[model samples]
Target: MKNKPTIAIVAHDAGGLGGMEIHLNEMIMRLKEDYHVTVVASSLQVTDSEGVTFIKIPVIKRPVPIRLILFAIFASIRLLFVKRDILHTTGAIVFNRADFSTVHFCHSGYLKATGGSRVSSGGSFFRKLNSGLASFIARTMERIVYRPGRTKRLLAVSNRVREEVLADFPYMPEQVGYLPNGVDIHKFKSIDDETKKKLRKQYGIPEEGHFLLFMGGDWPRKGLDLVIEAFNQAAERFPDLYLLVVGKGEREMYQKMVSPSFRERVLFTGKQSEPHHWFGMSDIFVFPSSYETFSLVVHEAAAAGMIVISTKVGGVEDLIANQVNGFILNRDRGEIAAALIDILSDVERYRVFGERARARVEQLTWENMHRILIRHYEENDQRLGQKALS
Candidate 1:
């Protein structure tokens, strides 16, 4: 006869292509199973919302800093009337005191890492200004929201992110939780040879060659150019090698980085929604991101039974055991090339690497992540009950 506990999730956007959007969508899906979920977002792309209630928050949609400011103001005002047992939000998007907060990226940490430079410092003037302004706004918001007693608990997506949060809010060490992002293991499992060939044929990828995959947007930060250079070096030894690039970036600009003989081998598939298909047809996954809280794509690639070569960024160290399951490299193109050559030159070794990589990430499922989150929620409830009793 008791009513289900209500949970209100607050974000600027509920669903879309980005990592945070996808995380919000997955969390919403899992929360809806038992809780009466309410989503307060500017725009939502989640489809099956039979049990969820959506409260739209008005936003500017341009000059991103303005959009973030407007959303924070309006969402806070909206939250004043919305009743919920738990107030869940992402980062510092709102001013209201929240029961839970998911910190995906630490703006303050990024500024610290980059020597107080904006992410787009090397970009055009307009881009540099916009990124600088956005970083400033986000850092200011974090200062206000991450203070003691403002948020009951903060869930960081990686250990690195957790450290950064503690670095900024040293007083709230016990309040910060480390939960690495999860991947859908079933959706990205190892495929049979027949299935791999079928996927290659379907995607128009050359079936005769060994494929290496580089997936993600923000080409510069993700080190797509470095991958191209590494692939070029690897290709000199193995002409049957090919690189599959999925996601957003200027293709022509990167194509120039490849030698004329190997340019055609570097296939750019543009933006892909279903990355599992590409993962199925690939043999190796290479990602050289300059920085990350957690690179979900690398984990997904490992789950898909691909020999992974990635930099020691984010929680990648948690997934890969260098030269055992996978190789963790520096940002140097030569090192990436050496890893690629080492993997490609050996058949049995690479197979073992892929299997070990898959085994490592198979346990990191979305279901497990949801369970951990639920545990956090129940722990909060227990604390509240004890406080009330006292």
Candidate 2:
């Protein structure tokens, strides 16, 4: 029998920790069954990788410029020495080192949309210095990683990301492939009304309150401020409204964004391992993120039979059929409150929308995502074998 094709997956982090890290872990776990899997990451804290070989490379934690440059150098050097049929990397300026590279966040697109320069006109000296230094490293890395003939193959997290990568690298329009992030439909299953009632009671949630959900790690980027503002505006119209925010963002910081009248109703569960429970209890899933390559949470919520009210950013339009499954703000902040009011005021409409939302995501399970990924890995394996014979 032919030996299984060797595959190496490189990510900055490992395990089912954080958002992207969890997906990376899942990919490794899924692929290990078909191939000899190895993972090179800066930090790995999970033990679920039984069949996978792991290589740890040291890099200083976040916001440190020297750390990434050192990581890129070390990761490139290591790949050159390792023998593998396919090399998958999360991000870095490793160029041809990684055969398949996943673009989770398009740094160049972000810079282009926000601004080329990171220095603020009236910012403090330290803030300006940090921003300027980080910007320089990021933009430089983007150019190197996305340069023509540098990347062997590019996979985007969303269609919007595919467009952004192609926009940055003009020749890659046809080459870029995108598959939206997948949710485990089984894991995020909807509970019956009785079960939801039990969960609400366990979490000290009022049965009378309409639960609005927000799940994300970054508060600023996820538009949590706007969530608070919109929730406040709708609070008067939709009585007994409660917002349950799950993830890393500080509850204290976000509470300031909420109005005094409804501040106590906002609850933060912090970061959670199984956020699916929260999704099952939510009346609506609201994400007004400023940008996203794709949001796994949005689909998770949908799978739990929850209606989504999100800003039309990134690949949200790919999932939500406005007024059918959910409402899309389409980048208009003003529409957030209006959308919330419409869904809250009409119970039948809300129920129908939630059902459609659930139906829309029923087909996009993690198993399907793994199948697509396996095809990509096998194609690379075949190409590598052919090259060896030649």
TM-score, candidate number 2: 0.91
In terms of lDDT, the poorest run of 10 residues in model 1 is: 381-390
lDDT of 2 by residue, 319-338 (tens): 89888888887555568888
User: Residue 70 CA error for candidate 2 (Å)?
Assistant: 1.8
Assess candidate 1 and give its lDDT. 0.86
lDDT of each: 0.86, 0.76
Off by more than 4 A, model 1: 119-122, 383-390
Clashing pairs in 1: none
lDDT of 1 by residue, 121-188 (tens): 25678877787788889999999998768888999999888889998875467788877778888888
